[model samples]
Structures are given as structure tokens and as C-alpha cells.
Target: SLSLSLYRAAMKGPGLFSDIGKKGRDLLEKDYNYDQKLTVSTRTASGLGLTTNAVKKGGLYVGDITTQFKYGETTIDVKVDTESKVTSTVTRAELFPCTKAMTTFKNSDLNYGKLEVQYFHDHASVTGAVTLKQPPNVDISGTLGSHGIVFGAEAGFDSVLGTFTKYNAGLSLKKSQTIVSLQLVDKGDMLRASYVHHLDGKQTSAAVGEITRK
Candidate 1:
């Protein structure tokens, strides 16, 4: 997933540079006499707020090939002569990222979006990330009821990154600023429920419920 995100970022930014890279790759393949190999594997598990039995292994190999590319005012020949594979099984708590910089952008008419990069704690490790996207706010909804008192319908924008979410709007039902409950509903052809809660810190509660399906 991270690799995919980086792929997208590269495509969106520095379009000319990316095109040059592709052309260079084509040129290299056309003239260079070399082959390469790469492989990676991983497994992970987390429990008790701690990581357990996490591991990763990867390696790379390439034959001799003098490659050069344009980088500012300098030329470089990056050749992977040899490589080795190693495995690491460390706890998640010990695996910390070296988040060096994060550039946040304020709302503006020009639409210069937000960007962030996080380095790794490992001296030889690095990972770059950026969320360069913003979707438009488009809402379309409709509701209908036959009763004379029927007057329930609602729609709104929502986003959840850390926890859970719910959406429920009805005329007869008493709306609330904070309402938490487990519900089982089968109305028309849909089955859904919306619960609400504002749980403050350092608080405990005891509640139980059963789940059923049709």
C-alpha cells in the first residue's frame, strides 16, 4: 500500500522528471547488458498494545552495468554489484519511524495541497509519504414517506480516521447530540443502524449486546 501511494505521488509531481526517468530506463535497457533480482517477505501480529513476532527479509542482486543519469549538474553511474539478505524480528514498540518533516498547508484559493514526509529511525532506512489529494464535496440524497406527519430526511458529510461513525436521520425519531446504542434494523431493503457516543478519557462502562442477521 505504501509503495502504491508513493507511485501515485511520483506520477502527480515532477511530471517532466518522471518522463525523463522512463526515457532513461528505456535507453538503459536498450544498451545495457545486465540483469537484476529482488525479493521480500514479511509477517506481523499485534496484541496487548504491543507487536509480537514481526519480521521482514529482502535482497537485491545485479550484474555489472555502468549506468548514468542526469541529476542537476552531475552525472552518476549507480551499479548494484552484489547484495545479501537478512531477517529482522523486532517488536512494534521498538520499530519507530524517523519522522523528520511534515508540511501542513492552510486552506487557500490556489489549492496548494498538504505534504508530509517521515524518515525512519534506522540509519540506512527511509520511507517517504505524501497525501496529495482533495475530493470535492458532493452530496445527493432523497427521502419519501406517506403519513401526514412524516417529515424525516437528512444528509451530511462525514469522515472517520481514528474510530467509528454513524448516520441516522428521521422525523419521528428524537435526534440527539450524543446517543450510543446497538441496533438491529430491517427496513425496506436495507439493514443499518447509527450509534453515537462522546466517551471522555479515564472512564469505564459495562454494556453487552448480541448480533443477528437475516
Candidate 2:
């Protein structure tokens, strides 16, 4: 049901193989009398920053194929569905030097585009992103953490007004077997909290939230 392997490469870096990266699952009714669903997927990664994933699924026959590939700082994704007769593709690239800064660019067949930049220091990171096409949008986020606690905040800015239009903040804490998180969002005036507990290598989680805006 599961398999894994590791091998050395001459110039492409180390390679790893595992069913953990690619998997297939089938779900049936409680009585196991009829086929309910099926899925097949595969993913691979190497030390040289090469990664790939492919998936196909349907009730009884494979109907679609989706694949993703990443080499070094560039990525490409594609999807094809036989049932719907639809195909889509997207490409992305990222760059980061020895410094604590990174930048990314993304584009899709639908003419969608985005750019992102991030900077990190010690236990903190800041990020900014913008849409590159019409109906432009921008967002900024920052996170700081130390010990067992992490705090983060994000805001969205209106492209035309150049003013913040949305804001959110969150906090997370972890200790031993328990983890807790809280988040607040401005648009819907929402507040959410979640708790997770780990027991004997298993995890159980619960979440509660509320929205005040109609």
C-alpha cells in the first residue's frame, strides 16, 4: 500500500520516491456493494528543486488529468478533463538570493497574472502582492513569532483609492500536544477559533466561528 526509495544523482541532486507523494483511493458505500468514487494521483520531488504531480479521477473511469511540474524556481501546471472537454494551464516563477527576500510571478492561460514579494528576518516575515491585470488589487501581510506564539496581520488595498479596504489578524499558539488559533476578519466582521490536540500520534481538532455582517 505504501512504498519509498532514495537514490543519489550525478548532477540533478538526490532523488526520492514514495507512495506518500502519489496515491490512489477508492470510496464505497457502507455495504461495499457499489462503486462510489475513485482517485489516482502522483507527486514527486527532488533535492534539485524538481517536483511533479498528476491526478485523475472519476466514479469508475478516469475522466480528467491534471499535472504540475516545478524545476528550480519555475513551475507549470496543466489540467485536462475529458468529460468537460476543458483544458487549462498556469506558469509561475520565483527567485530568492542569499538575502532574506523573495519575489514571484505567475500567469495563466486565462490572462490572469500576479506578482508577489516577501522579506524575512529572524522570527518575522512580511509580504506584499498585487494583481498585474485589470481590476487590479493589492495586499500586504506580516507575521512575527517567537517561543510558542505567532501573530499575523493582513490588509487589502483598493487599487484606485490606494486605501486599505479589508483587514485581518490572527494568532496561533502551540504547546506540547495542543495547538490553538484565533482569527478576525473585517469584511464580514468574523471571528474564528480552533483547537487541535494530538494524542498518540493522532490528531483531533475543533473549530468555532461567528460572522456579524449580513
Candidate 3:
């Protein structure tokens, strides 16, 4: 379930800063799901969407349901798991020209609430997030790029401990049909390099490779 957790965490923001070198990363990392979870999703013209996922565990099917609604620049999502715990998220985009904001609440725990914001420019992007609790954790990330190159870094801080919890950096180059990226992740405990090349103009076919060291 680590992959699913990571995917949910990554979905918290608008993805401006985190998307800096995402092409190569996606090419190298996505689509390796071995969990064998069965998922079905549908959307209606009324801006309502529903998704259900079921996975076999302990010879039984465990599942979750997620409902989403979109109206204008705002989106709302609500999810319920087999245990009947509810989580809700609201996202607003373009609140101030290229800015996005989101808030999430889990179950009935006030401490489980969180807020996130992101802003994007032609050559730069930034994101910030904080937990709505005493002694909360805070996160910040930024990226700068122009003319087919980008550099980005992200950090997390524990307000109560007054220490950094995480830090990572990445760089990427994108040409007409190829993308190369290098990332230092896991609080700088791992290094990775990835390359992706499109085989044709439509980008329907491609080659991808990656190397990592811990």
C-alpha cells in the first residue's frame, strides 16, 4: 500500500513544483503496479464522478469508494473506506491567476486537516503546505526553469522539533524528443537518473531507462 499512499500524498497539490521533472520520472516509475487491485471509475455530465477499487486480501475483497464533484474552478472529493472512515478534499484553481489552493479533512479529527497552495509562473513555480494542528509539519517546494531546462528542490520541516524532516532536489533537460533527469531523493539517501526518448512525432512510442543508487 506504500505506492497508493505515495500517490495520494502526491495528489495533494496542484503539481506545479512537483512536476518539474515528472516526464522522465513517470516513464521510469509508473505502471509497475503489482497489487492487482480492481478499479472502476465513471463520470457524468453533471460534473460528478465516482470510483471504486477492490483488492483481494486475506481471501476477501476490501474496497474503497471515492466521489468527486467539479463546478467552475472548484472541485470536491469525498472518499469512504471499508471501515467507513470518511475523508474530504476541496481544491480551487486560479484563485489568483495561476494560483491553486486545497484543503483536506480526514474523519472527525481536527488535527488531520491540512492546507496546500501552489503558484505557477512562466519560468518558476512554488508550493507550500501545512497541517492544521498545533506543532504542525510544514512543506515548501520551488522550481525554476526556462528554455527546456529546470531545477527544483523541496523540503519539509517539523515545527515542534525545529528540524528538517525531508529534503530533495532534481534537475532535468528536455529536448525535442528526449528528456533526461537526475534526482536526489529520500532525504538525499538515494540518487536516480532517468532518460526517455520519443520514437516518433506523435510520441505514441518511446524508450525509457533509469538507474538508481542508495
Candidate 4:
């Protein structure tokens, strides 16, 4: 629900999550706290250079789970300003989607490659081609139990919707009660791999591990 004043103001501009059905909002709710315990461990050295030591590392986190308890599918009018080394612009109108989950979410994306900038030089002409990336059908996996262990395999498609398409597969395992996952990708001419790990339960991060020719 929104305050009357808020509703009136939002109606004046463009925004997302302005109007959605009640059923859609109710299905998405967030509930999370935490449980705790204390454990101890020790190590002893063997005959050669044996040593005994103990170690521990633990803590708690709040809002670890992200659920849709605060918004719904809607739109409003607003203004936005964005800046980057690549481009800059002030946006006035936009359509947004507010859903329980995004079609694809990237926690972190790092691109380190040749920067395409304008340079004047005595050189031959160059032709350019526009590109789109189509993700490939992939295998997905998860784990369960105390260790989060190795859950199961889930498969998905990696089509950038008909662009630079690639095939991929992934699995998740629990390491020390923490969930870590990895994805392997393959293009027709090249192969790429990535690893993902969950610090808590929802913060998914990915890293591009290796890319090699086929």
C-alpha cells in the first residue's frame, strides 16, 4: 500500500512498481533471522614438524535474504542522471519491471579489455559489425544438508535472445556451511569459465576464470 500523497506524486512521472495486482504482491514475502552455535576444534602436528593449533571464525548477518515485501509491478514518472567514463545522460522517461525475481541478475560484472576510443592516425579503413549476445542452454546445480553439500543440477539456456550465443552449465556446493558455485561456458569458437560463491545465502558473485580457444 502507498500513502495517498506518495501515490499522487508518483502518478505525475515515470517509475516502476507503481501498479500491480494484489495476488502478485502477496506471493512474494521475505522472512529471515538466524540461528547460532559454538564449536571448538584443535590440530596436532605429526612426527616430523608436528604442531597443535586451534582456529575459529564466525558471525551473524541481517537482511541476508532478499524478498519482495516492499514493492509490486508498477510505473511512475521521474528523472534520473547517470555518469560513466563511457557515457553520460539525463533520462526523463522509462518503463521498469518490479518482480519477485529478475530474468537475470549479475551481482558483479568486470570487463577488462581494449577500450574503444576515437584516435586519429594514418591507417586503413576499418569496418564494424554490431553484435548481440545470446546465452546458451546450461546446467544448473545446488546443494543441501549442513554443508550445503552438493544439491542438484539445474539446466538453463544462455541465449542473449539470439545474439552472441554461448552454452553453459553450473553447480553449487556448500563449503564449510557456505554455498559456492561455478559455471562453465563455451562459445562456438571460444570457451569461457566462471566461478560463483555465496557469502551468505543470496549474495551471488561470479568471476571469469578462463577463456581459451577451442
Which pairs in model 1 have colliding backbones? 152-171
Q: Any idea what lDDT model 4 has?
A: 0.25
TM-score of 2: 0.57
- How high a TM-score does candidate 1 get? 0.17
- In order, what lDDT does every prediction score? 0.26, 0.49, 0.76, 0.25
Model 2 C-alpha lDDT versus the unseen true structure:
0.49
Task: List runs of model 4 lying over 4 Å from the truth.
Answer: 1-79, 82-164, 188-214
Count of clashes, each model: 1, 0, 0, 32
Task: Report the lDDT tens digits of candidate 4 across residue range 33-106.
Answer: 13442323333342111122222225532212111211124222121112111211111221232111112122
Better of 3 and 4 by lDDT: 3
Tens digits of per-residue lDDT for model 1 on 51-153?
A: 1221222354333322333333222223322232222111111122311222222322235342323222211112233333453221222223222112222
Q: Of the pair 3 and 4, which is ahead by TM-score?
A: 3
Sliding window of 10 residues with minimal summed lDDT for model 4: 13-22
lDDT for residue 91 in candidate 2, whole number 0-100: 31
Ranking by lDDT: 3, 2, 1, 4
For all predicted structures, in order, the TM-scores are 0.17, 0.57, 0.78, 0.22
Judging by TM-score against the true structure, name the best candidate: 3
User: RMSD in Å for candidate 3, one decimal?
Assistant: 5.4
lDDT of 2 by residue, 146-189 (tens): 67577878789888887889888777776776656666766548
Better of 1 and 2 by TM-score: 2
